[model samples]
Target: MAVGSASYLELLLASDTDVADFDEPLTQARAKGAPADQLAELERERALALRVREILIGHRRHQAELQLLNDTAHDLAALHDLDAVLQAISDRARRLLDCDLAYISLSDRDRGDSYIKAASGNISGLLRALRLPSGAGVGGMVARTGAPYSVLSYHEDKSIIHTAEIDRTVRAEKMVSLLGVPVVLGRHVIGVLLAAHREQRTFSGRDVNALSMLAAHAAVAIDNSRLLGEARAAADELRVANATTRSHAEDLERSAAVHERLTRLVLDGKGVEDVVQAAANSVAAGAWCW
Candidate 1:
């Protein structure tokens, strides 16, 4: 059990690549017949060093997760195209959760189901065209519950109401594990953000929280896009109304000018030919006068 205490101290101050430097020295010391007391103390130091390494790695991982979420928020804020925003969220989820594929499924209250809206890293059309009825699959459960759901092995899981179509599609995509979080807008669950793997993988609480944060971002993006579309439609209507009003105003002004010209000709005792000529000058050739 002999281990290098010096290497243990170095481990605490070392970079990730440098942490592996302890094992070789530790093996050499064990073979050299080091005294039992010294070996025990070195073992204690080695355990402490390992614990420190674990904490350091965990902290770095958490930091990276926060950065990913912050980057997602910035991206959503800058992006106006709904499809691009959705794809960005899905792609970021795959990278953040270290999963093989990620997708966003939107709830259709009208249809009483949730349908795939966007996906990343998916090769099969099955996943792209997937539509899960409410309470049928992991996504559907999340849609109904408005809570996050994680599965270590989806097909084998009996906790959810798995439908044949969803099961068949999941099998075709070769998805083993899954995680879904509700994309909530106000009091309603508008959609679900998901991450999946082809191989069995555990979803940690941290992973769930990260995906949930991104789901919140997705909700805001959807709401903002909806508002923007509405504003554009209203503006278009306003422009059309303004154009119509301008056309009517121009017609009224021309009619008033024609009337004034005819009155002046009558006061000057102009002939019927002069009056007809003045009317023709003010109106288009095909326009009739009574």
Candidate 2:
């Protein structure tokens, strides 16, 4: 293998599209029947170049993923609309994973199951409405284990307990590959994030890690959104309560003022006609007395 300098890696970083400049010359040298030793060195250089290209591409992809995540975080911070955040998560997952579809299934602990809450890219109504029993499908397994799960070919995967409805839905969507990661908040698994492809595709460890990171952020965002919603509701309730308390205070103050006036009138030994006149003066001029 040809040893490369730090500068060479930096050059690749500068422009990933410059692969042809490094590859075409090596191809021509081989075709011209270069010396065996020279050819070997060239071949090593070519291999190193290819490796550099892969690294550059991976770096660029990772950067994109981070950018997407940062943008999502900003959006979540600005507003706590859960549906909007979930929808953004689904869309970003599909783009980052480069998959045909992506969806989030939230755990309904009360129901002991997970249900699809948000989806992006190609999807059917049946798939949208799909639910997985606890510890049943891939998502369910991820939910139970709080781990990441993947299958290059879902039809051939025997590790996951397949359900008839899930199988039918997957077939209908023509999804052959799947990757799911648990969305965890603290120690509890709150939901699962899923990425799917129509064709069989093997996901790398990098892919799994990227998806897992997104799942982690998603969990935080979901929790944040929920807390924000609760906080807003509590604030509204507090406002209503404050308004009621203020109204009651006003009513009490008015009653106390009337009582003070009546007490003064009695202390002064006012006649019944004088007391009635005082009461009449207390009432608004145009208001009717009961």
Best TM-score goes to which candidate?
Answer: 1
Q: Tell me the lDDT of model 1 at 168.
A: 89
- Model 1's alpha-carbon lDDT is 0.85
Q: Which stretches of candidate 2 lie over 4 Å from their true place?
A: 1-33, 272-290
Itemize residue pairs with steric clashes in candidate 2.
none
The number of clashing residue pairs in each candidate reads 0, 0
Candidates' C-alpha lDDT: 0.85, 0.81
- lDDT by residue (tens digit), candidate 1, 113-203: 8789999999789987888887888988888888999899998899999888998888888899999999999999999998999999999
| TM-score for each of the candidates | 0.88, 0.82
Error of 1 at 127 (Å): 1.0
Q: What's the distance in Å from true for residue 213, model 1?
A: 1.6
Task: Please list the residue runs of candidate 1 whose C-alpha ends up more than 4 Å from where it truly belongs after superposition.
Answer: 1-3, 12-29, 271-283, 286-290
